[model samples]
Target chain A: MDTAQFNEALAHIRRFETMLVEDGALILKFWLHLSKKEQYKRLKKLEKNPHTRRSVSKRDWRHAKLYDQFVKTAEQAIRQTDSGEAPWLLVEATDWRYRDLTVARTVLESLAKHLSLESAQSEITTQSKPLTPTGTLPSTLTILDTVDLSQCLRAQEYSQALETYQGQLHRLAWAAYEQKCSTIIVFEGWDAGGKGGAIRRMTQAMDARLYRVISTAAPTDEERVHHYLWRFWRHIPRAGRVTIYDRSWYGRVLVERVEGFAKEKEWQRAYLEINDFEEQFAKHGNVVIKFWIHVSQDEQLRRFQEREKIPYKKHKITDEDWRNREKWDVADLLVKKMAQLPEQTKN
Target chain B: MDTAQFNEALAHIRRFETMLVEDGALILKFWLHLSKKEQYKRLKKLEKNPHTRRSVSKRDWRHAKLYDQFVKTAEQAIRQTDSGEAPWLLVEATDWRYRDLTVARTVLESLAKHLSLESAQSEITTQSKPLTPTGTLPSTLTILDTVDLSQCLRAQEYSQALETYQGQLHRLAWAAYEQKCSTIIVFEGWDAGGKGGAIRRMTQAMDARLYRVISTAAPTDEERVHHYLWRFWRHIPRAGRVTIYDRSWYGRVLVERVEGFAKEKEWQRAYLEINDFEEQFAKHGNVVIKFWIHVSQDEQLRRFQEREKIPYKKHKITDEDWRNREKWDVADLLVKKMAQLPEQTKN
Candidate 1:
């Protein structure tokens, strides 16, 4: 109800409208305005008629009394939300015929304009070009290079540290439960970067009652019908619980972007949508943590081979995985773009 | 909420769970139990640790005091909502290891069962068989037969009646807008039955600001990804607004049923789903009206030929319309089923 909340809502609605328009929706909003005097005249005339009198409720009278204030507030909202993509039309409503005709004409014109450009609109060139790892990019010194591969933990030390950390995590999960703070953990990684092992360790530390691990694979037939984020939203954690996503919404910008599964506009707009979504978590006092695990190409190859050699793990290595291995430039773009997202938008 | 509202919510949730399971989803619900003494002890211990003390809030102590009440409420909820499709598993949670292991084991078993039956599930026989006009159903005395085609309006009288009715409807629309009552009009009809013509007349009568005419056609790529109902739900009328649908969700049971676009189970399940959806409209105090226009086969053929002869109306008659003419039994089943639906369900 406050100005800040109202303004933010207006911004959110405008963002949605712009996104729809960019995606080729023909949006035309109209506000049929009645003059305060004309509105009063119509109300009184309806009140005089027994059959129509019941229609004019107390709320209508109250609205009529505050018509000027209502108009002012509406004007403010309209001004803030107005956009070239989905422009608002203000029509005078003294004559019902004129108002109806005007609105219908506008609708017809918008539809016709949309239909005429249908073929041409399909030829819009995507702005995103594939990242070429050679020449335009450095041969070395990537964000992945910052991970010191030589770092290792001895078995005895690893066991001790793991127990201590796990114990702490178990206690923290309970404490968070007590405070009604739900948590979301998003995992993104190279195909063979040991995400499953890391997730298993994390889940092992927490009481199963307190967390749900959702392994994001391909979209199911049901999920395919909704927006990509719909499936993720459907499984949001309840209060005092945790949801861990193995491969999260960042797929739009990472794999989908590189693999051409998502068009440039879709993946690009997803950056803002994701930020807005995370903002909801913040607003609700929930905890969100994300991770990106990187493995060198040689290390990935080693793990892929190790998986193939194992009887139970053979299914983990697919032809798609082998195909994805050729896209090193994807990792470069993903790392850089992901690192910059928080800086570029309000989260 | 009142007891009635609470009970209705529980029933709604159980219904949703049943639908999901029927659609081949494997669902699991769990309740992790802890004694009041154990909960108090844990809270006390956490509060004593500086690292974890910050996580224990006043709400935790309040909840501890209401532990018995919470347990009773939980029991009632569990009793009402539990079903074989998604049964709740209660785990004794004094031991974290046992609780976590129990949950993980249950999940594994459910997944294993689901995966094992993947191939066998696809062989499910659809219950619905196409109706033949020849023998099975009565060849005459259909619901459509009740309509007297001999009834006709004089041109002069028709024009006067149209103006009078249109004017009354226009006034009523504004009245509904003033009273904040939304109206949803659903039209289901055979091709060349004047659904478009009727919708156009209705919209012409109402203020364009107060009504939107949604001409339901084949699902767009975006819509095809969602449930068949998704497109219908997307254009729901706002408060005081009227949404006139030229074709409607009844297509699931009508065209999709006879045409086999939706399997028997899908269409059969839609009967209940559609009722529940309309129940929401009633709950919101919105107005809903439905219409089915039928034209005799000979009359339909005459109109088809007449339409084809006119250049402007040529697009109105398509090959699909000519093809659908072969399925008179669709109209028969549609009339009987649609007529029986309200009586069969708690609509």
Candidate 2:
């Protein structure tokens, strides 16, 4: 943990971030600091036991050798790179009483930031953008409307329909894989707007051999080091396979942008950057599907409250939701911007 | 390479695979190897240039001290963990030319193996077992029967329909991202069976913000490690995002199983394993969509012949296609197996 190496790592991080943005990705970082005393205690325990000792790397011991330098370097990195588009949340990990609470709150806040951006961007696309004649459909119309939901398949209509679609998609996906086709799907909506239900319904019908579901939340340590998009890029489906996102990269515009965690330029440019990315995807022959579930804000409140009341769903709610509820107007403005973009404008 | 350590890695991989089976995830692993001679060449190159000098590690300079030990360990790891469910592909890299060709063939063959298994399993579910109702629609219906091709949302009629769906899905995918939902979609069909057409249609309508397409062809040096399924798993969609596979995981039954690249048991159990995996996906609320474009064998032949006559499509007529054509009965048997499985069994 020589201060020089620490500073150099920070520089490396900055350069890495620039490259990520150039490549159409963003990053959010965090630093969890356990006090020197606490680290020493943990080190002592490990030293006392050979079993635990094996897991401790020589690198760890070296890091411990210069704890102060490590801390100072981490602090410098945080200070230098933390910004609206990519912010760093520092956690004091000494007191157990405070650590969990602080970490959870910060994570909740970050998630809120990301989710709000999603909400805002969705609102913009669905609400502000006027329908175009080239290929764009009216915003009010639902893809479901095209389906003959009323034409009823059977007693097990949902299951049967799900199976039919999943089976065909599975096979088609494999064929695409043979041809090197990559797939990405997006889902968004008001709270508890059946996004999860819809995902389960669709996934339940396919062969798991060809697909996988990834849930995104707060960034982990390794994730923090890379750009936000880096983590997501890491999840890109190989050619001919499916990669689904419950929530995705739009967080810059919807959550981070609206919540002031990201500057206007950051989220504003994301619309174009995202379009460029999709252009690449299309060029590669990826089958890209994006869905937004619509529900009244009142429905969201009901679900939010319900989540608070349910033990299992309790994990779903956070104080930040309450805070976000208060900033609907700000969020709405961002949504309008998202909606104003052309359907397929290349960044 | 050290045979013991090689076996240890192999053992670790097998353990990981078993764990994934019970956990409903596929464990894919990779081993990257280059011979000592090649390594020396690289080191020599690096040492010869001022800029490339740092590429040589102290470890390389002291190879005499470690090479024998390392090789022995690596070999041992490889042998110990090779299993029926997950086996290792030994890439002989003494000759770069041979290695490249071998690796490419191995990848294509490996993919075929897994896909054929999926196909066979589906066939068993659809044919061997009772196609009894577990509540979903029958697994044999064509996409044309279900989707309203006649009631077209014409270019001018609610022209924004595609964009709307894509946008909505985009938001939904991001929401899933926040929630960390995993999603997968697969497409399978004969060549010219509208797999590419359908995928293009889907992509044309999607918001680029939330989706990506991955095209699978021959594997490069990087992907050969890990199990065949590892690369696919790496792309699992984060919650709310979707991945579409033009051709997907069914290669086991359709290609590998038919071609004799995989052992009987490997492809046989993929059905149950696949089902278990899908069930886990459903439990986790990720969506999976599978598509199989059905075309008569005559249709396939006509298309294959057409590829030979056309300059652009000529590349599509591979010797393997002709080889697979010779084993139509075996291929059909595997396809039947794939058709037999119920969505409930897998999803």
**Cα lDDT tens digits for candidate 1, A1-347:** 89998898888888878766766678898998998999999999989987668667899999999998899899999999889888999999899899989999999998888887886767776555654454243345545557787778899999999999999999889888889999999988889898899999989999888999999887876677667887899889999899999999998887777766787778778888888887777666788888887777889999999999999999999988997888876566566657655542233
Where does the lowest 10-residue lDDT sum fall in candidate 2 chain A? Answer: A128-137
Task: Write down the lDDT of every candidate, Cα atoms only.
Answer: 0.83, 0.65
What 10-residue stretch in candidate 1 chain A is worst by lDDT?
A131-140
- Sorted into a CAPRI-style docking class, model 1 comes out as incorrect
Clashes of each: 2, 198
Which ranges in model 1 have alpha carbons more than 4 Å from their true place? A1-142, A154-187, A195-257, A260-290, A309-315, A329-347, B1-140, B154-186, B196-253, B260-290, B305-317, B329-347
* lDDT of model 2 at position A313: 94
Residue-by-residue lDDT tens digits, candidate 1, B97-140: 99999999999998898887876777676556654554243444
True contacts kept of each: 0.00, 0.00
